[model samples]
Target: MQNEKRDQLVVSKKTYKKSNELINAMGKGTALSQKLFAIGMQNIKVDETNNVVATIYGTELRKMFKSSSGSLYEHIEALCDRQIKGATIFDWNLLMKDKENGKIEAHQVVTDASFKNGTLTLRYNNSLTDKIVNLQKDYTVLSLADTLSLKSVYSLRLYEMLKSAYDYQRAVTKMQGEMVFEYKLTELKLELGIINSGGSKEIKTELEKEFPDYDRIDELAEKTGQTKYKEYKIFNRNVLSKAKEELNKKTSLQVDYEPIKNGRKTEGIRFFVTKKDAEAVEKTAEVAVNKDEILDDLIDLMHDDFKLREIRELAELAEYDYDKIKKSYDYMNSYSSPVDVPIAFMKDCIKNEYYNNKTTKFRPKSSNSFNNFEQRNDYDFEELEKKLLDN
Candidate 1:
């Protein structure tokens, strides 16, 4: 779990989504710090002074860290101490570029947090709270179920980047299964917390001229093997591959990338994302299928020989009409368990068809069992590749 487990938002069932603007302004922090911040975002309140406030109960806070680094109670105390009494507060630096004035408008959103008797109440600096709150309408909802399984800060950061940019839903009718996004390598690195922020050549030159030379940091990074991601090859090997491996292994999304080329050089990354059926992975949401659809239409949806056979087997076992069989598959995806190993799981479902004959059923609990099955399949695929290469 990387030194800290993924910040599973267990404090409440309510999912909290924050504006990208707010998320961007929060500078570097540990995974634990981020987990605490996420908890505070659960519910926002407006006070008598028109100020924005968010409260988190100590019990809920403890729940967020229950399976993480240390004892939940101890972590709660330590986090509260740092948040309340620490001299250097991690303040928000909400900034906007004023190209017309050749200046940057920075509004610092200072947090005044208090903890007493298992409750945390946060009061935001009034100067920019309104602006930040206004952007909430355009917020990204972080998937709590997925984040709980995340291991490292890097993976969490990458998860946020992909969720915010690519995988987020933009329309109501679109399939939420896959997303493709292209990001500049430098921007991608920044999103992963690999390095500090960067801007255009002119802005970099202007800032460089204004500030003292800090180029020695690059040399130090080279000596330390950090390498700064200056070389394309190393960036792909050290950063992109590692993130892809972790996400594909642990999370619901399948992540991959195609290099964007500048004629003979790699300049950016085009990421291909495929999200697992959340209903399937969680085995919890119910979706109604059309009873009007004829058997032929349902058969068309399962347009492969094996899938057709699987459907036929279920049809025969459950003594269900084709329309009924179709509903079973749909309900299995939405209300039953995930189908990572579809063929095998389908066979198992066929054997136990009567159990699901009434309407819906819960497959055996596997604790993110879908991910476990995914990891096994990936391992098997890798072994097959090695054998093919040897051949």
Candidate 2:
């Protein structure tokens, strides 16, 4: 029986679906650990014994993060120690079947984790198999690339929450309206692990006692503080703002929030989430380009610099007529002068049928010319005419 269970796809941009409950899992880990958890989900499959497991390799980790040889092993060791120490909490308050009650279940996600030969093998808890594996509906599909690109654990958690909420509204609700989510301030803080709201009063009391200065965000406490994000302003500045910035800069989602207030006190947060087209995540996850293919090849061969995302948007503009897109791309590339912004110029060329203007060669007077062009003294008219006639 084959024991290995990992994805065959070389690129991590592949998508994975998780139940909404699981997506909102309040378990916290380091940014890399959270990323590893996402990768585990992406590579999830049944092992020889029919148990769900994910196998990750050190070499793969190095490649994914582009880490050096010496530090990579140390990082892997640190990750293994964290998982073994139960630092990556999978504990979640899963909803009961009655739908009126919630149960605080503390379960180790990696029930059994072993590191051998620079590979880590993890066996998931039996109780979570249903939530993580057997999903029928109310699931959120996420890109592994997008999740991995997030640097902060808060950003990752918020991204998952917003993505899940947006997907559910669009697909399940089907209301054909704007997607918005409102969360109580305390609830949001709890979810982001900013504050501890444990199941037992004893645990909560213990946290409060240990971090007695948790809520002190005064000018003095701001300089030297034990706990974090006790005040709404501090929380907004530290967690919410950073998460929003990272999400907008790195992921496909655009998110903004307004504080729900009552009597000058913050009550809750209302979030507005929207998805971008064609350009989902960063190009950090570079899929090996196939030279024979037009979209991938163009992405690979283009002399102009573009984010993997911008290139994808350009391909989407092609509308399956890659030949025309290629012509525009060639026109942009063959121009004697340098283009200030190649993508914008190529987009205009594709949009306005500039690629097909065979009679006259268009040369721009300035670097930012998109609508108009002026002839240059060093214009290679002979070569341009030759190329046009050949076409």
Candidate 3:
């Protein structure tokens, strides 16, 4: 019974999508609060009319947070006080669409919360939901398993930041190049919630507007007692290094970074990220461990665009029929040219048995070649808007 119940709460295979804006939101919360918030976001369900709400049972919460001390209800109550701190301005102009640019912000994500009979109920702000729901573009997929597996708030946030940036590099920008992330040192610190409420006079003034009572840095620290990594060396060692090590070792991404210098001072960071191959996938999670050897073999044969989770599911569906699956994979890859979305095409080929007795070259209705693409050449509008709108 214990094993069965534990199985019911396993979230390692679940995934959620969030807009790039939400992924980069300057949100601050405790590690547990962030995990809870992520789980809440994952479970949010929208009806035909677009109404949505999330309910988290105390049983699952206790299971996930068994390591925490004190009452679980207390944590739920404290969740209401957490704030998301800044508005996000999405520049639709970059897409070259005719639509106007839009702005969305929410002071608090968990607008209301209540616990009764060992279950916690949460109502999210509409502004927060609007960005996530029905997102047509500029979004990133968040693995609930990956988020829950991470222990530190910094690691979780860094993972999301890098993941979103990597997605943008791949999808929207159509770069089709190696994953690279460069951020100003001050901006990086703020994104990770490390040096909150600091920087130039303009930045400080804007942050002050969010909390009128704490107008000055010292006053804010005195009242709320800020925990900040002010020293660059310490922040690099404790936050960035630790998160990088954890993300590389445990998650689907392998990351490495170095600080950029200006004369004598470190001014920015440049990160290199890549997707792990089959061998690395085999080493990380227990689910991969328990799968048959055929799954790893299939993963080795597949492309990078297909996620590890999706490949795992596909492997199970194929029922270890290596020959049949391999035929489908070969059919897709050996087509006249690459499919616009190879994964979707491969799924159909396998499900519909299109590989059976196939001899002719398969041609997609249309194909978008990702080869020889250049890096993003424009950052003017986005940088300006972020500087003006972000806290």
Clashes of 3: 0
Candidate 2 residue lDDT tens string, 226-286:
1477678998998899989878866778889999998999978999888766544333222
Q: Per-residue lDDT of 89-206 in model 3, one digit per residue for the tens?
A: 1100011111233222224555556667777776655545676577888888887767766766788888889988887777767665468889876567656765454323444454
- The numbered model that scores best in TM-score is 2
Q: How displaced is residue 343 in candidate 3, in Å?
A: 53
* Candidate 3 lDDT for residue 79: 38
Give the per-residue lDDT of model 1 (tens digit) for 185-231: 65455445454423234333332343423344333434444447678
List the candidates' TM-scores in order: 0.53, 0.59, 0.56
Instruction: Give residue 163's error in model 2 in angstroms.
Output: 0.4
Give the poorly placed runs of model 2, Cα more than 4 Å off: 1-12, 47-51, 82-101, 175-178, 202-227, 279-391
Worst 10 residues of 1 by lDDT: 284-293
C-alpha RMSD for every candidate: 15.7, 13.9, 20.7
lDDT of 1 at 117: 73
The local distance difference test score of model 3 is 0.60
Alpha-carbon lDDT, every model = 0.51, 0.60, 0.60
Candidate 2: 10-residue stretch with minimal lDDT = 1-10
lDDT of 2: 0.60
